[model samples]
Target chain A: MSRSALGLAGSLGTTLQRELQLAFSSPGRIVNPLMFFVIAVSMFPLGGRMSAEVLGTIAAGVIWVTALLAVMLSMESLFRSDFDDGSLEQLLLSPQPLYFHLQVKVLAHWLVTGLPLVVISPLLGLLLHLPEAGYGPLMLGLLLGTPALSMIAAIGTALTVGLARSGLLLAVLVLPLSIPVLVFGAGLVDTALNGLPLTGVVAVLAALLVLAGTLAPLAIGAALRISVH
Target chain B: MLTVANLGCERDERVLFDHLSFSVANGMLLQIQGANGSGKTTLLRILAGLNSDYTGEVLWRGQNCRQTRQEYQQALFYLGHAPAINRTLTPLQNLRWFCGLQGFSDDAAIHAALQQLGLAGYADIPCHQMSAGQQRRVSLARLSLSAAPLWIMDEPFTALDKQGVAELEARVDAHVTSGGAVILTTHHALQTRHLLTVVNLDALRTESA
Candidate 1:
């Protein structure tokens, strides 16, 4: 590879490391989201959900909503720290393409927060009394769907970084955007629960990932440009 | 050589400056003096290719800066009013990250630069734990590591003490002595006895008005 290619790779790697370090540094940040996930799943059992049938019927929605909320909870830290401490200005002034940097940031976010949600979905599914056959589809759907959440959440993170109460504002901005991922993800689990072929739902989840991968960076870059002004 | 011709900058309908023309050749230091809120920082941003809302032509080596932004940026190092250091990472980490972005992979040079900035002991310490002056020094350390020919700094001495100010002045002198060009905005009267040109933005604005 040429020198520029090496530099770009290094930039991405360093950014990924920094993001992971920030996410896991204080237990407060990571633990809160994990607790939120557990509590959300537990709610299914509390609301007359002790029966396996009752819990299994609502398992997919519970898991999807919990994963979505976990991602949303962690998304605010994406650009807030950089913006607050003036590192965002340096990023904007860098000689490399800012869009490339933004992409690296989004990827890092998925690796740190979204990847964990995928890894832990099985445990949450168990709590909700998910059927054995639904496990694979749930994890698969989450693996494909969570990155879409990250990409969509980045747009909201960039837009609300300049606002005073950006946390609540971010949820308001991103929840509407995350509906497609929720639909496909939950649809896959629902299909599996009913003994129906999940090929269609899985395909839609993949399509959503591709669509978000293509368009989310442009939206994020535009939002950063507006907010930095 | 760098030249700005017919530069006009505005923010949200308020005209900061208009029809400003300036030129600096090799081995020259241009000090832009202006009062608070006089658009000095805005002018520097326009020069550094970060702000595009302005109307004018900034020519570098006879090439239009706006059209050849990457090429121009490759030759320019801009330090804004805010010290752009990541507080979570150690100074060494921040430097390594920045060097990586600039396509530099030499850690020895980065270490040498940190030492030169009197930050050798604190290189591995996160910037958030350092004092303001020390954090500012980390930003100045880039001046030693970068090979860019043009330096644009906004209030580089704002957080520095007397000793730090002198240290920064020495760095600026050394840079100018090596045939590099510098454009800086400052409230302090720089005591450099080199070939320096002072552009009073307040006077220029009054004349233009």
Candidate 2:
């Protein structure tokens, strides 16, 4: 492989490994998000009297919000360690294009944090009494949407990297931008639960992912320049 | 090998610098001296192709560096005030990543470069566990690993101890000896027996502007 291509691979590999190590080292990191997922799902039972009708209606919203929060919780780490230790500056200096490296970092973030959320989401789905039919579309929607979340989250991570106590700022910056992912992802599952064709919702989610995929790297790249400066 | 003509830059409604023009050919070193807020870093960024908000042109071998960014980047390595080493990764892993990014795939070359930097013993240790000087060494080790002709370093000597400083000076001298060009900013006077030119930004700002 070309040297630049190999560098890209190595960068992505190290990013993935480091993110996973950070996630695993802090039990609170995993438990907090898992708890939020469960609590959000469990609220459907308590708030709605455990009725199948109410549970069925709210399950999608509960799961989407939980998933969004879970992803947001981890997004701060995307650039924090690099910024704190001056690696981000080095990265900016690299002969390789920053956009390509940012894309790799975003992908690694999705794999380490967002991928696991997708995997365990079915358990949360069950907590809300979401039917088995909801599983495929819910998982699929997250599979498509969570990466979009990470890519967009990178913009926030870059913007807030130099700021003090940036975790809250990261959420504030990313949550509004993340609305489309939540909308289409939940819309996919909701349509599935309602016995409607899910193709349209899935298509929308896919389009959202593609759009985010295309534009977010540039935004994040710009944000990194500004933040570092 | 590197030249800037009529270079101008401004940030946040304040003019950082303007109409700056200079050139450094092969085996030469240019030191950019400036106060904390004097756009030294910004100028370095423009030369490195990271910041484009500037007027005029930077040329590498008579071609506009901005126009041929990838080519320019391929021929240069910029070490900023930040070390850029991934703390979680071992020094070897960090160098490996940088080598890959710079388009060097030979494992032997990477190991030899690390060994040359006196990091052979700490190659397997994570950067976070290494001392500050060690982390700095990991970043500086790139000087040997990369064959890029131009080096733009921003305050590279900031955190180094006396020994680290001496090691860096030796590397700088060796790099220039090998016909590489160096452009960097440092508060301390660098004693290198070469065609070293000083561009004092404080003087240039008032005189040139």
TM-scores for every predicted model: 0.92, 0.88
Can you tell me the CAPRI class of model 1?
acceptable
TM-score of 2: 0.88
Summarize candidate 1's per-residue lDDT along A195-222 as a digit string, tens digits: 9998888888999998988789899977
Task: Report RMSD (Å) for each prediction in the order shown.
Answer: 2.6, 3.1
**lDDT values, one for every candidate:** 0.83, 0.80
Which runs in model 2 stand beyond 4 Å of their true positions?
Answer: A1-36, A43-52, A165-169, B11-15, B206-209
lDDT of 2 by residue, A1-229 (tens): 2333455556556545555565565556556666666676666677745577668667778888878877787777778877877667666666677776777778866776778788888887777778888999989998999899888888898898889888888888999999989888988887887799987888888899889888899999889888876
Which clashing pairs does model 2 show? A3-B103, A7-B100, A7-B101, A87-B84, B1-B25
Chain B superposition TM-score per model: 0.97, 0.94
Q: Give the top-scoring candidate (DockQ).
A: 1
lDDT by residue (B40-91, candidate 2, tens digit) is 9989988887777899999988999867777877888888777888777787
lDDT, residue A214, model 1? 78
